[model samples]
Target chain A: MATIITKEQQEKEKMVTLVSSDSEKFVVEQKVAEKSHVIKMVMNCCGIESPIPVRRVKGDILKSILEYCEKHSKGEAQEVMEKWDKEYMDKAEKDLVFFHDLMLASHFLHIQELVDLIAVTFAGMLKMKSPEEIRQKFNINNDLTKEQEEHIMTTFGWAFQPI
Target chain B: MEVCGVPPEQDKTKGFSINDNADLLAEILSRLDGRSLGVAACVCRLWSGVCRRDTVWEALCTRHVSGGAATARAVVAALGGYRRLYRLCMGPVLERLPPARRDEAGHVSLSLSLSLSLFSIDCYERLGGRQRSSLLFLRNTVDVS
Candidate 1:
């Protein structure tokens, strides 16, 4: 016979509030927000006296990040976390604009985990692309002179032929 | 330098200004591997400057030579401790290094091939140059070794 286990009692005992820049508020489980080092540090110092104000993070972005924190906060099996992180990153790549915005928001909110994830994804996109290709993809402008281009080629000659 | 002072004819559509999203871009680029980051440098002058920043290159080198013993020893030797090392992934570092230390007899041909392989790692690390003179010297030594 299989044994049934109840949810951990400590998980439901606390809560916190976060206020965004536009005065939008979110009620979050303290355990979930605690996954963010920034929030944890604030709570540790302030002793839950004030609601944390993450001025730059908008409601939608905060919602997604909280969803991430909540899933991750479970401290579930390692394999499960890895699988979820993978799926989250894959889902994030489909909307580059939203991902980009979230990266900005993530940085401002000092959420290291989200920031690192977005950074790695962005780096992967940059990994194989030539300068021209990068320019095209990001809608960047090419403003270097002929001399400058030559210098770049000679300096990075290895990257030229390999791929 | 007057802050926000602009001369006329500065077209806003020229492209993404480096200053506009620099922090975000830097944070993003920091996570890339060495080879990919090196390629990104070739994209343009703006990116070239950003990539040339010592921090970026250092991060690349750290990742590139993280585990391999042979590759690491060869690179540190050629570039003088990851700091002096500019770009180490090019082609010419594999040119030549005589296999036989002393004798110049029948073992010459075999030694040359070995030297060439040794040279490849260094050449690859330094980025390639059209040093035909060096290549020929390497070839001759390999042939003689």
Candidate 2:
């Protein structure tokens, strides 16, 4: 006799439909989708039946986030996960534009772990770097007047001194 | 609140996304050591505002501050905030500093004391007419020191 799967079993294995801002649809496991607090809340409020829209995040960024969520939700070994996360971030950081988008998307989605990962990576880049080096890395323009910068440096000069 | 009272003296880059957002910027800046954070503050006016946040300095205080949390420190915190409090506390530990930094440590230590004296000056300001005298006294004292 053939085994008949119950409706409850099908519901138990239900996938969530995530629609990105650019109209890209991703059908992922509910566990993977719930990695984002915003998506989880939406699923709860709307009963997970309708396709949820992640409007602030574009397709490529949302896809990357979902990849991370899927990998993390798998309950892999710590070493494996750590290595994977490191490789993922290494790849992401190469393109500053992509990294910025990733950071914003994770932040908007309220994915604490992903945001922390991005923060740690950026902090690692900043560690022990001089002000000029930091400016070059981020391509930032100094907006302070020479006088203001000089004054603040003198006032808090000790902090800038190499340890 | 305004970050600085002055207009930009240079052509400002309208850096968007992570750079423009304080919460994201602080997430990265807060993890940095004092030297890196200080460097970041010098990066731009926006970074200075985030980098000087009391919460950022409070995290550093928890890490670097030894001994008990004193009530006296709270008084300094009330007036100048935790960054100032951390600066006052971190003035010592000559062993970790470079020779140039040792000189700066001494200079900052002196300034910290001068700022502390400003508290006494504040009390005198409350007592009336002596405000100008105290201000003059502080100016002269700072100049002399």
Clashes of each: 16, 0
Can you tell me the CAPRI class of model 2?
acceptable
lDDT by residue (A1-163, candidate 1, tens digit) is 1222223433333678888777888788887888778888888888554678987787777878888989978889989888898899898776555677678777766778888888888887876676777776676778788988888777665665652
Interface RMSD of 2: 3.5
Residue B137, candidate 1: Cα error in Å is 12
> Which candidate number would show the highest TM-score if scored against the true structure?
2
Query: Per-residue lDDT for B1-145 in model 1, tens only?
Result: 6788454333332433333677777777676655566677777666777776765654444432323434444545554433234333211222222423222333333443333344564456446654443432433424435
Tell me the whole-model lDDT of each prediction, alpha carbons only: 0.63, 0.73
Residue A17 shift from truth in candidate 1, angstroms: 0.4
Off by over 4 Å in 1: A1-13, B1-19, B64-86, B89-145
lDDT of 2 by residue, B111-136 (tens): 44544566545655757865555542
Docking class of 1: acceptable
